[model samples]
Target: MIPGQRSRPEAEALPPLLRPRRRERPAGRRGGSALVVGLLVAALLLALGAVAYLWVVSDAWRVRAVEGEAQRAQLVSTSEQLQQRVDALQSDLAASDARVEQLAAEKARATDLREARDR
Candidate 1:
């Protein structure tokens, strides 16, 4: 070492390029944490909206199923009523056929009697 100059440390003797710089805020920006929080809140709101839409869709499905069941029940009842009416009509038709047969026999007997008298 020279007589007038003091000795330097090993770290200081290294090149300035290897040294770290001081931390500083950006020149024209606000706090970055507020922006991140706002984004998180927006994401949360979107998730809530999705959940609500799913709930509504599920409820609608349930309502549709219930309505379908009700319609099926109504159809069954109507079919049963129609079947009863058809059975009653068939019974009435059978009675009418028996009456017509009796009337036809009476008419044939009357015609035979009248032919004998005319001869």
Candidate 2:
């Protein structure tokens, strides 16, 4: 209501705590923080790659171990089969020997009979 004095602006009328803060420098001057963040990201990626490599190597070794066990099992089965076949062959050989002896005796008896008849 005074003739010469003017009222304060709305912003000035607010309490000091409600005013926005002012920066002396622009945000462009703080570009170094971006480089630091990029380096951190690269480090994280490298660590992840190392972990992946270890996992791959461990998996390969495990697969090899499993394959070796399977091969050994197959070999054992083959050995057992061969042993069974050998046992069967041995029994057959014994039977053949008994047949050979019987045939020899029969031949001798026939020879004797023929000689007596001639006399």
Candidate 3:
């Protein structure tokens, strides 16, 4: 017997269930369609991932814009409160000056009356 050749009886002795099945298509032809499908699926996943990333980034920008508007509103409210305080202080200062002027006029009248009595 040759080193690698099988005897005809030995080759025929294997059961049909244990024999290797032959493919209808060649090996090169078999994987081509599957490769295209795999690449398309990969491309679809990549596109979805990019869209999700953009959505997340846009949402972050929206959140930042909302926070900035809130901060601006808060600053405006604070500035208005400070202006009110300034106006109130100015009104109090004007009332104080008026009272001081009235007191000085009364003191002058008293001095004039005293001098008139002395003469």
Q: Find the candidate with the highest lDDT and give its number.
A: 3
Candidate 2 structure quality by residue, lDDT tens digits, 1-119:
79899966577768898765676555765667777888999999999999999999999999999999999999999999999999999999889898888888888998999999999
How many pairs of residues collide in each model?
0, 0, 0
Give lDDT: candidate 2, residue 39. Answer: 92
**Any runs in candidate 1 off by more than 4 Å, and if so which?**
1-40
How high is the CA lDDT of each candidate model? 0.90, 0.89, 0.92
Evaluate model 3: give its TM-score: 0.53
* TM-score ranking from best candidate downward: 1, 3, 2
Provide the RMSD of all predictions against the true structure, rounded to 1 decimal: 8.9, 9.5, 8.8
Highest-TM-score candidate: 1
Error of 2 at 22 (Å): 20
Instruction: Report the alpha-carbon TM-score of model 1 versus the true structure.
Output: 0.61
